[model samples]
Target chain A: MSDTPENVAATNAEARNERHRERMVRKKTVMDERIANAQSERGLLLVNTGIGKGKSSSAFGMVARALGHGLKVGVVQFIKGRVSTGEQLFFKRFPEEVRYHVMGEGFTWETQDRQRDIETAGKAWEVAVELLNDPGIALVVLDELNIAFKHGYLDVDQILEDLRNRPLTQHVVVTGRGAPQALIEAADTVSDMSLVKHAFQSGIRAQKGIEF
Target chain B: MSDTPENVAATNAEARNERHRERMVRKKTVMDERIANAQSERGLLLVNTGIGKGKSSSAFGMVARALGHGLKVGVVQFIKGRVSTGEQLFFKRFPEEVRYHVMGEGFTWETQDRQRDIETAGKAWEVAVELLNDPGIALVVLDELNIAFKHGYLDVDQILEDLRNRPLTQHVVVTGRGAPQALIEAADTVSDMSLVKHAFQSGIRAQKGIEF
Candidate 1:
């Protein structure tokens, strides 16, 4: 009786499968119990105040998540318009569910036009307001809009008033450093991402895939 | 003229808003661009290998993202049986989009019935596989499924084969420790969450609303 390695391996695999089957036979299980679900009602969310990593990343991740379910998601990015980044690049993959709009001036320094910056911010705000009213649109991520309010390009009062008045089913996410008192107070969930430490502070240039 | 503190505070608030508006007008602002959307073609995936943290949390985060877009998602947790969890608790918020299947056996040591464990895992897998194929089901997260394979309660190859053949548009995520090499190899993108450092090792019990 010759015993081959292949035969032995096969025998072992069968035994493993048998063991697995045995375990399943004795365990009791429950099917269909979910704890966390997406917010159905309209609410305001402020991803605010602090120099921390993953604020934009987290927001974009949410955007991607929303788009995955065939939801109309509108994103308006502020204080970021240099070269293309990961989020922007990936946004092209799903143009139907996601609409991407940028202020287009790049950072506040590169434009060097104060009047133009305010005009651009105001225009973006108009679009965001319009999106807020569209019930078909499930999420409106105002990326870095806090910086706009902090800089005073757009009226904080108007922004807050509009957000409050927007359709109740529309969920809004405002992200940026130094979110104002008004925005924070009006928001249902306020997440302050305090930066304990960062790689950029240590002189590590942002990597392509990880940072961008 | 009676000068009151309330009057002074109101005046200060208006001045603060004015100052912010002026500063924003001067800043040259740009918006972050969304390059493209998420890779929806990438089917659902779960990474369960070794006890670091961020496994189930990350998975559930994606689930929330999906649900926010009005997409249906299902979750099945093994080894987390007979007990309530933060994820389970949160699922109540969205009773429609999120469906859960929990094994009542809890952990293997607690049950000590290998046959029953395997049977329960098989039953859960049956439901999970059903969801994986459902085109309307955008994302399916099998939380802590690695334990099922590790303890000989589930068949890794069979699961991988099923996933490989599932609906192309549907996304799935699995989270747990000790994920099998076969599953890793089969994944379109495999993120191995190595434990370089963890808060739990430093004498911090899992806190509610954070770790749980």
Candidate 2:
């Protein structure tokens, strides 16, 4: 109420706060409507793909969340079996809750045998199909399955068909780079994890319990 | 060797495999050298930010990894205290292993009080600082702290200063949208999660286990 500079500033701040509050009220109404309209619930096909980190990590995070809710999770890692990762070591502890299978011999370059790679991928897919068909498995993470599709090791059409026909209440998270267009189209949620910067590029070694 | 169609295909495949093997051998040498050169090991400042999902989920994944390695973990959630997410519910089960703190009244819009929001963020920062200072806590997750900085509730410079002075082997992961430029520069690794498509956009509600 005073003419002083401090009082004027306070008054202006109050007005701004009032405006923000009103805007938020309008936003809340719209959000409420959207939430109300979204009554449908079922399985989701989540794709975490791109050239960035965290795609698999995010999927693993969901694995943790799923386990928290006492859900059974099945993880079929398709192309990273050379060295054991931290996620593998950690999730394997919950043997009853998580069915984790590290199905790759190693990276494609390391494998270098096309016939063997296809065989390995086929084996992994068999395990994945089993998980997908099981109603008890709440969340199935097909880690790096896209890379198999990208390298023509697995049939994309077949993978899509299997994903489409999975249990009604089961959730699937597919992670890796170059997720096929068809898979993206079939996905319910798709996150493109983009690399902004990497510690490895900055001369930092990938350490245990972090990168792995 | 036979000159039949099957024989010809086998020969071509063998030649291709040989060529690929040679390429991989060369690549391995370069990779081995890079691995040998990266000898430095210490604490890392990691930032996961952008307008997409999984920023927090990936951080949670790292927390799982850290815990898997028998490392102590700490989590401080900012601007997400209104609703108890699955991560919070799940992580809270491990009281001895995890020092989890949910320190926010709600989102900024819901709170509608700048003073209160700032105070809550300051309190969260206090908890974060404690985690950062503890050398025993191997990994500390500052979930949605970037949003607090984005809304001007906390000082970026001060946050960076604390991060820089943390324990020698401590690893920190900050997750949320609009990570400050300073924080990104300070980070060892930064991932920008971009939304390709979201289920909520397709008339699906945020589910209990997946979204939370």
**lDDT of all predictions:** 0.63, 0.88
Q: Rate residue A73 of model 1 by lDDT.
A: 80
Candidate 1, residue B20: the lDDT equals 51
Candidate 2 regions exceeding 4 Å error are none
Model 1 lDDT per residue over A18-120, tens place:
7655554444232111122221333445343445444565566555445544457888887665566656665645677777787546666555555677888
Q: Which residue pairs clash in candidate 2?
A: A86-A212
Best by DockQ: 2
Docking class of 1: incorrect
Model 1: residues >4 Å from true position, as ranges? A1-40, B1-212
**Predicted complex 2: DockQ:** 0.69
